[model samples]
Target chain A: MKTVKNESSKGSPRPAHVLQKSRLWLMYPPRLITTPVVWQLGQKHKVITNVRQASVTDEIGIVCLELEGRRADIKAAIRWMTNLGISVEPVEINIIES
Target chain B: MDKNTGFMKALKCRECGREYPLEATHVCEFDFGPLEVVYDYDRIKHSLTRAVIKSRPQSMWRYRELLPVAGEPTVGCQVGYTPLVKADRLAKRLGIRELWVKNDTVNYPTLSFKDRVVSVALSRARELGFSTVACASTGNLANSVAANAAAAGLKAYVFIPSDLEQGKVVNSLVYGAHVIGIRGHYDEVNRLCAEIAGKYGWAFVNVNMRPYYAEGSKSMGFEILEQLGWTVPQHTVVCMASGSLLTKIHKSYQEFMKLGIVAESRYKVHGAQATGCSPISTAQKAGLDFFKPVKPNTIAKSLAIGTPADGFYALKVMKETGGAAEDVTDDEVREGIKLLAETEGIFAETAGGVTVGVAKKLIASGHIPQDASAVLCITGNGLKTLDAIAGHVGQTREIKPSLREFEALLDKENKLINA
Candidate 1:
């Protein structure tokens, strides 16, 4: 099958497959604070990782991370992190105040 | 607009400062920051004076101008104005010079402070033309939303953890609300509701409608200030679930001071939590700017939010005001409940136990100075969480209703007491 370029009505070029962006909060346990997990994630996964905010202490590390890539790759990346004992939650979940 | 919007201006992102229309949406699209209801304080300053509030009926709606509703409240109108009792006996026991109990355990309709938030959310939901309202609650919020929605004649659905106490489950079910029991914890229930809120377009009080819903807690603080003769207490101890109430109470004090309704005064707003689920308190105690979520395992189910949404902001408020945070064990929680009940005749839930227990520790540790005045916010009644204290409270002795038996029991009790 011939791949058609994904484009808007204005005909600007885009990725062949739609890219999805997700914002997440990644919580690292005290032992995982210095693991360079984000670097490893970018090297291993097809997704791009951006750190929006981070607070590191001896006790714990919390990072506001934004991920952009194919949906499946993002899911796999999150699953990998979870397997490593990292807590991954959507940023939207933080909107609830009750 | 055909109806007045009270004094609310718009929903503004707490992080990015972006403004959105006062709608059901609760997060900023660009940054995922929580949106909060912003008010036109200049207008509220003129309209919501002490005289205007005094002339109104005693309810949370008495502060309508500051609440984020489009018009007069139509649901749970009788909520709030719960007594702020002088807790002299409790103060003496806790080693504090003065203390008050904001007794929200008897808040109208529902027996918890959730009634205040539900009233505001439902009122705003009606204005937004929603016919069905729902929420993801631990227990108290479910009870409040169920009861209030029934009285408002709106369809209601409340999702809660399947492991909630039977008393709370019955309270919600008795109101005819569709009470769903999720297999996981409250955070999971809340996650599912966030999706449902988007897909079904129902007014999820703590999800999409949170900005307005959270403003309801300010009433508790406003009442505290007014009941204290319009003066901010030197210290306030509030229990945290998502830590929303603590932050809102701080906001309430700030709003009153900004409006000149109360004189500017330095006050500390301490936070309390169960040790089994104390993300906010742990972070505050560690002097950290953020908190790591933990799986909750505590008798204080109402305050068992492992991943508190407002944990960061709550920490900021506590640190900014020079406040302290503390957590109590399950044993200490029971002791706190017994202390409050034996001293002040107030039967509070585990959350209240956490507050009372923490207040004692804070007072003892000098975080709350021994001589300073304080207020403890009791957010719920113990009846809803009887399971936590069922076997822990002293048992009743079975006695025959005969004079001989009564005399024998009195003699035995007197001997034991004397011993």
Candidate 2:
């Protein structure tokens, strides 16, 4: 029964302050495909960026990224990525039946 | 636990191909990809013949072997078998050779296609020993879950956007289900429901019980095939919410073809969306494999899911089938509703209007050739969302109950026509 709230399911145990985990879909434009945006995000912010799934072509790149950290830090990291022309969206799962 | 699991083999991950027990689970733990139910089609091909299906009752459960239920359906047994209306007048108006409407608006109990999914989900929930069920909906899914859960004597908690239509809200509330109104968009409510479903053990139909719930949509496609004399339509224009219905419809056609029921034929499965929430359509138009999520602002609330779960798959189906996708404005949606009502006398909800509007566009742009035949899936009834067309349908003329007044009014109308 793994819930989304459990941040310690995958990696090393974090402090209680680093509580939030967000699953995001990061779309990289063709120009940014060669850029190490995920590494840059982890270097700049107090967030752990884990790539769950990725498919990169010459035209575009899409990565299912899981970010674990304080809620504000994750939000700030997302804002920074968006500022750099990355389309940051919440990962879509089974939310619709019809 | 049921020893016999019907024709279903196991829940398989769409990405990783890892199999899981057929239970109330939706996503793969390792890769986070959605799980789908795989079936033993060989056994199904032997048993589910056209004669066997024709001998059964006229309901979705007639195709029970293909549905994911272990035993008899205790929920909505009379959910599907909606009409496949040949819209000749609408076809002429849209400049298409032939047009058909898979009218799920008059579906049993719920007056929407959600009844099909809820029926399968609740029945599977009971089979899995779950006493409570829930779902996060824009409107139609909430009504179906509330109604079907009430009928099945299961406790239900339906979460929806607070700003849904009054008719839809009342439809759920009247069933005595706990309808939680979240003051946010559908995407926000969906995120909250994901958290709730993870914490609680309740069977959220579109979350934990999604693979079974989604398989129910195939019944709609099955009925369309059967009603069209066991032939797949050349074009199927389905409105997109999470884009699940369009993909399932394509799957249905493929399943029937695989079973040797329908002769192999080339068909296109098009997708429709409101311009306000046209994520999948926008991506298809831009020739992108992935869609960018958008905040929804559509009058078609039922199809306003900003992040469609099956969007990628829907795009794949369209690309593979040589189908096109289109989106329409709110005003065009209203016009579509009116056009269907005036031409075919079938009043569909906003999502249906989106289907019709997009069908017209696809025909006009020659994406769907003018001579090609098509079927537009009208998923919900218009009466549920009267607010969307309340001020737009035009005003009624007030007249006293008098022969003299009626004659004068007729005379003035006749004079105007003559002039």
Candidate 3:
């Protein structure tokens, strides 16, 4: 039997120094729902984009995604996505500690 | 030895009924439907007798046959079996006949109902060969996860919004868990945790291990019935955040009736929410099938889930059970907390306050009758959320050490000169 992977479970060193992977939810307005922002994100930056879940309607669109790249490149891509009218937010916000 | 010996049938899709192995997967790969735990009732009915359950320890494990865990629970063994107090004074204040309070404020360790779910989730996480457990929590859930995971000796990572209550943050940090503060709303933290779960193979109690985790909530319902002489209450008012607890309690009642634990009777499960972030309650009131997510703006931080994952199921339960949903303003939440404290001597958190406050409205609007027996779910303690009602509860009065000074003060406030 193959062994189960537990590298991350072993309290591995933080990944914040080099490569970074982030899960983001992007909400698109009606006008931008049809636009290819996710496609352009890959073309414009050195990032790997994977769509985890998406819901599209006539008025609004929401997409849950996984983005992997260098920390600086990922930051640039997120800023670009925000400038293009897509609301970019990180995942797993169960606690509102304000 | 066949490792899976329990009566658990399989994990079936809620929408399509497609079966999958009892693994950590929560959604169907084919249809993306949420997977629900299924059990063989015939086998459970034969063994899960009242005497058997009564003979076990008083912790949530007493209902282990109903829970989804396979092996003996290795974590949070002391959780559950909280007091279910009969609130006569609270009932009189609300102009109702009989009222009960399922007080989970005194729940073990973290002192909230979340301990029940975390206990089950961490146990299943260990059984599934995972060494790390994580969650994206509002506040109570983070505290429970941190405390339980510490006792279980598992690596824990808790993510929360940067603006959570100081008490809740301290509760988690005191348990020595790795706490990460995200500079966003709870929904954003939830999304990030989901992504992290996908990339890293840690067991996120509410995300990846959700099917088992949610089953823990049924214990609350079971205890509610068991404590009430094995009878269902006419109405059960629950505080809703992600709406899972309400739906699970409804399921628990149904499960008990199905297993011959209680005589079947008509019962309604009402959901309560704070108005600032009431997606489910708003949808239910508008008679809509879906809820629109909102940016949360409430002092009841624990109940600030804008996009409740189980909102649809919760709405369905409310409709099918002839129940109504209501939301309370932040001011009403404080008032509700004070009402419970003064009348029942139970200091409940804002979520509990929301439950009490919404129950008050439901009674006034004739949704819940004044004479009908009801149970208001007090999910968390007021001490964790003191900031919400700090300036509102009233200031303390100073009295001198002498009876002469006290008499003068009393006479000044209420003149005794006539006497």
Q: Which of the numbered candidates is closest to the native, going by highest DockQ?
A: 2
Q: What is the C-alpha lDDT of each candidate?
A: 0.86, 0.87, 0.83
Name the lDDT value of residue A46 in candidate 2.
90
Which portions of model 1 miss their true places by more than 4 Å? A1-23, A34-59, A65-77, A92-98, B1-4, B184-190
**Candidate 1: what lDDT?**
0.86
lDDT of 2 by residue, B1-419 (tens): 23468889999999999999998888777777889999989989888999999999999998898899988899998889999999999999999999999999899998999999899999999999999899877678888999999999999998877776676678889999998888864444555666666657788898888899999999999999999999999999999988889999999999999999999999999999999999999999999888876778999988877768889999999999999999999999999999999999999999999999999999999999999999999999998888899999889877999999999999998999999
lDDT over C-alpha atoms for residue B52 of model 3 = 95
Ranking of predictions according to DockQ: 2, 3, 1
Give the candidate order by descending TM-score. Answer: 1, 2, 3
**What is the per-residue lDDT of model 2 for residues A1-98, given as tens digits with 9 covering 90 to 100?**
22354423433444556467777777887899999999999999999888989989887788888888886798689779878988765654536333
For candidate 1, the docking band is: incorrect
**CAPRI-style class, candidate 3:** incorrect
Residue B129 alpha-carbon offset, candidate 1, angstroms: 1.8
Q: Name the better of 1 and 3 by DockQ.
A: 3
How many times do residue backbones clash in model 3?
Answer: 20
Identify the leading candidate in terms of lDDT.
2
Candidate 3 lDDT at B56 equals: 91
How close is chain B to the truth by TM-score, in each candidate?
0.97, 0.97, 0.96
Candidate 2 is scored at a TM of: 0.89
Scored against the true structure, residue B279 in model 1 reaches a CA lDDT of 91
